[model samples]
Target: MGERGRFLLPKRKKRRHRTAVKMVLAGILLCALLLGAEHRMRPMIETVAAYQARLLATRNINDAVLDIVQEENVQYNNIVNVRQGIEGQVTSLTTDMVTMNRLKAQVTNRVSEYLEKQTMQEVKIPVGTLIGGSVFSGRGPLVEFRLFPAGYVETDLYNDFQPAGINQTLHRIMMTVKVRVVGVIPFYSVTADVNTSICLAQTVIVGKAPSSYTDIEGGVSPFISQYDYGLQAREKLPQEE
Candidate 1:
């Protein structure tokens, strides 16, 4: 109500104004601090997001590379298997060819041998001055009178002979025969023996000297004789025929 009260009131009002101003300044400082914090946090969030994207890209690339590598390995394995199969087939074909060649050679050799043997079995006897006879009274007697120049005889001795005076003669013969080589058959060496009887009582004996009589009585005798020809005669007989 007086001058002192009025002065205090004015001073108090001025103090209140100063306090309000300070509060306003503090509010502005708090707002700037919050804005600065928000700006800094935004950059950190972007950096984290970029790092996550890079990680995802790196993972995807690695997975794709792994898939490609696995595929390549599978292809390589398949190629190797195919190569092995081809090599095996080639080896088997080569072996079969060798076996077939061997069989062909064997068959050829057998055929050649058979043909050679067959060729040797066919031969004709040479008819020449061949003396064949039986023994009569310890001397040689003409049993088979065959003129070598006129008759054609089978050298293999496979034919039967009709004697001039005898009815029949049985012979089991093993002869050592010399045959001239022709083609596939070389010279054949044959051995044969025969049992023959002569009818000397009905036939006349020839080709023996009169003075070279076997018996003192000068008569024919029944006997078995073995005759052998020389190699020269055997060779010449085939050539002449």
Candidate 2:
């Protein structure tokens, strides 16, 4: 209640106001620091978000690309299979063409060999071979002939059958043989001329046959036929070959 008591009270009030002002300033400063930290971290957070987004987009793109690549590979495989099949067919067709009737007289060669080992053999005689017999021997197959154990072959023959008279029926012709008789005795072969009308006989030797012979039609060779007994010859002969 005195003057000193009044002075102490005023000083205490002033000190309290100063403390409150200091507390308010400190709070404002902390708030400003928090705002600055938030501002600095905002760009980093945005960057992280963008990075995550890019990663997700990349994954989606990769998945799409992988799907497309797999589809293309499957298509490629299918195309390759188709191509292989086509190639196989083409190769088969080519093989068939190349293998067509390659041998004319070889078809009966096996049978002839088998029969020759047992008895008389019949085989196709080559051109330019000689035939033995007369025209009155009787009609038979033009391409079939018999081979005896003496290495002599009696076969169908075709040669220059030109007749001087139209009424003079000529039967004999000439042909050549260049094959070895498997069953013949020590290969008894002779290269000579013979006379025959409807049939002929000749000697067989291990050699190539002539490509052509002088026939009534001139220069006739049965081996040259593609559609004949050869791979290309499909027409049936007038006589067995």
CA RMSD of each candidate after superposition: 54.3, 43.7
Task: Give TM per candidate.
Answer: 0.23, 0.26
Candidate achieving the largest lDDT:
2
Q: How do the residues 170-227 of candidate 1 rate in per-residue lDDT, one tens digit apiece?
A: 2121111211222211211222222222111121211212222222233223331111
Worst 10-residue stretch by lDDT in candidate 2? Answer: 90-99
Query: How far does residue 17 in candidate 2 sit from its true spot (Å)?
Result: 1.2
Relative to the true structure, candidate 1 reaches a TM of: 0.23
| Per-residue lDDT of model 2, residues 66-96, tens digit only | 4433533422122111111332321100112
Candidate 2 C-alpha error for residue 13, in Å: 1.9
Q: In candidate 2, how many Å is residue 167 off? A: 74
Give Cα distance to truth, residue 191, candidate 2, Å: 99
